[model samples]
Target: MFYGDKLTELRELNGLSRKDLADKLSVSEQAVWQYESDKVTPRIDVLNALRDLMEVDTSFLFEPNMVTRGVASEGHIAYRADDRKSRKKTRTELTYLRYVEAFVDYFEGFLTQEERSIDSLRSMTKQQADKIQYAGSQREQNLEIENLAEVSRNYLGIQSNRDLMYKIENSGVCVVERNLGQEIDAYSTISKSGRSYIVLGTHKKSAVCRNFDIAHELGHLLMHQHQNIELLTNEEYKEIELQANRFAGAFLLPGAEFACGFATLARKSNPDYYVDLKSQYLVSIAAMGHRAYDLGLLDYQEYRYFSGRMNTLHYRKLEPLDDKIVPIRPGKLRALMEFVLKSRLTSVDHIRSLFHVRPQFLINLFGIDQHFFDQFEHEKHSYYGGAKVIRMPGA
Candidate 1:
């Protein structure tokens, strides 16, 4: 029997509507709806078209959706996208995230998941937020965010600004780099299976920008875990965005240390002076200047002059050392695959059979480059005979 839900999932995952699929199949929109509703099975040609378009095997339509069977929901997604985000785009992104979570869940079954501090961090952040109420004055909320940042920084064991992405991944969060379109920078969410994900965009962003994006999403993951972002008003959403920004600044640059340093080097409003500090802090000059102002290291007039000098120097977009420091990429998933494949625990064919998708589909879905899987092609032997389907508890 064909699974309509599978078709629906693929359609949405591809960011397509029933009408769009119907047009592709040269069928009526009602026909596509019926196929998705399981009221009617698609013809062989239509099925083949779907298999071609969705980049899945024909047998995928009949197989049980292992991805959705274990997972109940995608959970609340907190992203810093444009305010004019379309409903369709949001749906596509969330469904895409759900599929990624399902893939990660599959890979995690064979490995020992060490105890993580992410849960404790979230609990601590929530407790702090409750204590502060965050609904008080601006100064009060900023203080609360600063406290949360410090708490998270300590929990993640970030002594310096180095290896932030690695530390976050070590805390049991699955971070992935993906092209998140033009409007969005990054997003994070907790999956129904109790996994946290942070997706960073590969869109023309500098290394420091990506670091800030990660910290921003971390703020969302910790601070707004309970808020239903989809139901939030525009003003409410803006408030959270501001809070996340403040958290990012505080998290990246601790107030006391940064202020102490800024007082020595930042006597005047010179963007060039920040260039040297940028190398040490690994933060953009604009961000550092903003943090200085927030910390009262720069007076209003001085900060305004600094902003003018920054614009004059054209350091807003691509600053110095932007290209020198390589942007961090997520390696946990790649490392897992390496361990599994290199150890002969599994094969590429076995993975394909499990997912029932083409290699290109997996490549596109994971948002990793094409050449990543090519290296493992030499080890494409069948290991399914020895591989047991381990049924994990609560999975």
Candidate 2:
């Protein structure tokens, strides 16, 4: 029997309304509702059309529901967007995240694998969460954020800011670039199962900006983990966002080092001078100026002048060297898949079959390029250890 819940999952994951899917299937809106309500099954043609339209096998509609429990509520998700997304958009994003988590769950079955970086990272995050101690006052909270930033840096074991992205990935956070629309820069959420995920916007094309975005979301994961942000007033939400921003600034540019570096700059107010520091810190000039102001290295007048000069130079929108530093894409998922395939633990066809989805659908979930899947289209391998074994003559 066809399961309506699975259809509902796919429809919502596609961000489509019943009417949208109905029109695609050349059927009435009510017909689509009935199919999803289990009031009626789709006709053969409709099933085939739905299969083609959704890029999933028709048999997938008959499989058990893929919904996973303990998904973070939309309100629980920490977003770094300029404006709040609509409920529909948030639902779609969370739905997509749940599916990604589900896929990771299935993928990890082959490894028994904490030797898998993600697994070890998850364990570390849990331990760190227990040690977090929230402060009572606003001033204390600010101090706490600074402390956490330093703690996070120590946790990642990086000596320099340059390897921030690499350290974050190794820490077991799933970071991926997806088109999160114009307003939203990034978001992070932790599942009940202890999986941490950060989704970065494709609009943030600058490497320095991406670094800050990642750090901002990391602040959310570490600091705002338990807050019911959806229940907070507008003012309260803004406060947390400010805290995350402070955390990002401190995390990317540690206080002592940043102070020492800023001391070396001859013209603290000149944006041009900060450009020299940008290459070393991989931080935008504007961000460096803010850091300088925060650290009291730049007085009010100097900081004001730096801000004005940034706007004058158009550095506010597009900073110098923004084009030179290429942004880093999230690599843990891709790396895990490569290890699995090269180890001959699983074949691409097996994964595709397990998900009952086309390569394009998998591409959306994995945040990987289509060519990666294209390369494996014709490849086949005999399953080893799990079900079948391939004998090597030399062995």
Q: Give the TM-score of candidate 1.
A: 0.86
TM-score of each: 0.86, 0.86
lDDT by residue (272-355, candidate 2, tens digit) is: 988778998888888888988887888999888999999999898898899999887776676666556666667667766667
Q: Write the per-residue lDDT of candidate 1 for residues 1-395, one digit (tens) a residue.
A: 89999999899877678999899889999999999999999999999999999989999999988776433233367777765463336666777777887777677677666556897788756887664445568787788889989889988999867678778887888888776778888888887767788888778988888888989999888887778876888898888888888999999999988887787784557878877778887888899989988988889999999999888888886788988988777766766666566665566788778888887787777766688667854322232224444444433
TM-score of 2: 0.86
Model 1 stretches astray by more than 4 angstroms: 17-34, 43-46, 69-75, 84-88, 266-268, 376-395
Error of 2 at 260 (Å): 1.8
Worst 10 residues of 2 by lDDT: 379-388
Q: RMSD (Cα, Å) of candidate 1?
A: 4.8
Q: How accurate is candidate 2 locally (lDDT)?
A: 0.77
Alpha-carbon shift of residue 179 in model 1 (angstroms):
2.7
Clash pairs, candidate 1, are none
The true-versus-predicted C-alpha distance at residue 1 of model 1, in Å, is: 2.2
> How many angstroms is residue 252 displaced in model 1 relative to the true structure, after the best TM-score fit?
0.6
Q: Pick the candidate with the highest lDDT.
A: 1
Consecutive 10-residue window with the lowest summed lDDT within model 1: 378-387
